[model samples]
Target chain A: MLVARGVTVAIKGKTLLQDVDLSLSPGQVLAIVGPNGAGKSTLLKAMTGERKTTGGEIELDGRALWHWTTAALASRRAVLAQSTEVVFPFLVSEIVTLGIRRNLTAAEQYRLVQRALVAVDMSTMSDRVYGTLSGGEKQRVQLGRVLAQVWSHGCTYLMLDEPTSSLDLSHQLLILRLAREHALSGGGVLMILHDLNLASMAADEIVALKDGNRIASGAPVDVMTDDLIAALYGVRVQVRGVPDGPFLLPQTARLPG
Target chain B: MSAGGVAMPAGTGAASARRGGLMLAAGAVLLVAAIVAALAIGPIFIAPADILAILADAAHGIRPTEGIAMRDAVVVLDIRLPRTILTALVGATLAVAGAVLQGVFRNPLADPGLVGVSTGAAFAAVLWIVFGGMVGAFLPQAVLAFALPISAFLGSLISTVLLYSLATREGRTSVAMLLFAGIALGALAAAGTGLVIFVASDQQLREFTFWTLGSTGGASWFKIGIALPFFAALFVGSFWLARGLDALAIGEAEAFHLGVDTQWLKRLAIVLVAAGVGAAVAVAGVIGFVGLVVPHLLRLSAGPMHDRLLIGCALAGGALLLLSDIVARTVAVPAEVPIGVVTAIIGAPYFLYLVHRNRAALGG
Candidate 1:
């Protein structure tokens, strides 16, 4: 389980996130959704221990996040940042292999990397140079890297910040499905998502942020109402319930230029 | 589906390890050959066999053979051998420094010389040379004699610390900021060096000029002794830094997430670069291009893994420097061109080609 209580993040004297509280348990997929600049990414960074919170604390597996050594924390959790910016021409295998903890033997590392790549459907591109890969392919490769990081065993925490932004429609669904599978298999996932429909479909619970405040948090079916969506985004949306789940459609017609 | 459109091969750590092993072995062989060649060449050309025999005798503490001329022994032992050894040390040190800096800066174009470390060291060396007599008035002779290299090391350390602090903000180093800061620092150090030049006497001017142009002509067992410890420090530091740098090459944020202690890595890299390049500059003047050129060339052939790249840089940098020093000595015969001139002449075109190749990345 991962818990972030009253987390606040400030940069250059400007508060990006304030008093935001969230938690995730084993087998739960919690999606953070909001408009642009809603502190979604900042909140994720705080939870992952990437940013030092201005106030409050984050805990993982019932222990304070800071109490764990970085290496020990890495084996239990993984983070996928927004972009995979590599300056050199590293091979895909090399990039994916970076996630393995140093304790693993050579054979163990090779097997885990292969399994992670297979999970992301990037097995065939393992030998390619990462610099030459397309945007969607790079995203999947990054997913493979993070997956390998926490693949050692049970109840890992996977934190992703807009991981599917660069991905195409199918790849986006594939990545979210992988995250869902991880959660279903007794791991916890904290993801920041822009696609409301995907978030509704995949997340067990949704935390909505607006201007660095948690506007709502509940089951997606309860909190993703048309009125709540409109208030959060300032854009009118039509909520339609289908057999699969609730589907959201923007109802506002564009004004003539 | 099929987005990569490239051939995928099996993941074999064995194969990659084997290739890296071969590359390192080949580099070691080339370095030894270059050492032998460097020892054998000069105005008074000793045979390669004689050079090896002289080295073996020295190793065994045996006197020179009965048939060997006194001039041959003196030239090989007192003069050329020390220069070759010193050149190798400086070459290897600067090369590793260059490789590590390029990694830390996340730019292939980042060299110790370009980033003001060498220029800063040269400024300090000039200060010591011009003011040593005045300072010697108060200090003991032994400390005074040793102060030149120590001051140079201090100068390089100060400049690198300045560059790193200026460029890094909020745990991120802006590449453009780093390059601009390097240029600014280089200019400031150059201006200081100019001030020293203005106050220098004719003899001081000549000595300072040699420091600027760079040479191994003053190489002696004593200078080697002064530089060897720094070389060892950097060599071990660079190898240890290899994995952290490899992780950093992806990105700082990503590296930290992967459990790398990024701040420690940056501090260690900057210090090692300062110490290695500082000692090299102190001993051999401002030998340029070996750091910039050797690592880039090896990356093209050896892949970009820092473990192999760092080791390869040590060997290739040493070999390239020996080759460059040989050319420096032989180019104008007894007139002897400055080594800095030789390295730049060879390294400039490659630099231009690299710039052209990376033009898109440079956002030009």
Candidate 2:
């Protein structure tokens, strides 16, 4: 389990995240939804120990996050940042191989890379140059890298910030399904999602943030209500209940009626 | 599987790995050829058979007792042998340093010579050359002999650290800032070299001029011994950095996510380049482009995988320097153009072409 309590982050006299509390447990998928600059990424970075929290603390599996060495933490959790820029022209398989942190033989490493590539549906393009890949393909390749990192670690956390931003519709659904499958298989996932409907479809619980504070948190059906969406994004929306969660449709002023 | 094409086998990298290995083997063969040419093609022109006989005799600690002339034996064994070894060592150091720097900076254009590291070391070496008498009065003879390379190493280390800090922000390096700062640093070091030259005696000035232009004409066994330890440090340290550098090609934060200690990697790479390039400059005096061009060529042919890239750089760097040294000696006949001039003549044009190709990247 990963936990952040009253975590606050301020840089250069401007607060990026304020006194937010969250926890990610194994066998669960948690989605953070917010407007731009609502600190969804900052909260994830703080939990991953990428950003130092100004107040409160983050703990991973009952120990402070700072106490864990980088390698040890990497074995327990993997991160996919919003965007990764690779300057070299490494092959798709080579890029995936970078994520293996264990002492595997070359054959074993290759097998693991193949498995991860298969998981992200990039098996056919394994020999392609990463630089020549389209934006969506590159995003999937990066996802494959993170997947390869914690492949054998049974209870690792997968932290992704906007992992589906550049993905096409089918790939986006494919990633969400992968996240759901990962949660079902006894690992945890924390994703910062921009599409509320996708979050409703994929996440077991949702946390809504506005102005660096969590405005609502519960199961998606309870937290993603019409008034909460209005408060969170300052837009009026009609929320329809579904078996999966609450689906939202933005409604403009009804033509000034 | 959904597509009609066949799925790639699990060992997809095997073919490329084999090709890379073959390229490295080819580089080794080229290096041997360069060594033989460098040993046999000097002013006296010793035959390859005579060169081999002299080497075999030297290996057994026996004097030449066959058809070889005593002058030929001395020229091959005493003069050309040490010079060839030093040229190879300096070349390997410069090229490996270049490869490592480019990885650390995550920019293809980074090189010791182009970034003012060699000039920085040269300036300190010039200071030692001009002012050694003042410091030599109190120090032991042994310690005084090493003062030049030590000062040079310190000089390179300072410049490398300074350049990194000036160009990097929040873990990302700005290529524009790096180049601008390197140019400024190079000019400052050049001005400092001129200042040191102004105070030198006529004999010191003459010696310093040759050192600045760079040469292997001054190569000797004792100088090689001075440089060998630093060379070994760099050679061993680079392999340790190879994996970390490969991880770094993504980005610093991303490398950290991959469990690389990026800070330690950067520091060690900087030190390795400093020690290697500093010692090279102390011995050969600012041999340019070996660091810059050798790795680029290897990357084009072999690939940018640092493990293979570094090994190729060592071989290719040595071969290149040996070939350049041969040209330096024979191009002007008895005049002996500096090896640095030979390399710059070859390297500068390639560098301009690289700049032209990368103009889009550079504009930002």
TM-score of chain A of 2: 0.96
What tens-digit string does per-residue lDDT give for candidate 1 at B1-364? 0113322244533334545667788889989999988888888889888877777788899998777776888888899889999999899998899999888888887778877888898888788888867867898877766787778888998998898789778656676677789889988987898888887777775665566669998899989988777788899988888888988988888888888888899899988888888889888888777888998988766767898889899998998899999998998977888999999898878778887887776576
Give me the displacement of residue B3 in model 2, in angstroms.
31
Per-model DockQ: 0.47, 0.47
* Residue pairs with backbone overlap in model 2: none
Question: lDDT tens string, model 2, B144-251?
Answer: 777888889888998889899998998888888888898889779978988888777778755655555689988999999998888899999999889899889988
Give the DockQ of candidate 1. 0.47
Best by lDDT: 2
Candidate 1 residue B66 Cα shift, in angstroms, is 5.1
Candidate 1 local lDDT, residue B57: 80
Residue ranges of candidate 1 with Cα displaced over 4 Å: A152-155, A249-257, B1-19, B66-70, B132-146, B202-206, B360-363
User: Each candidate: what lDDT?
Assistant: 0.83, 0.87
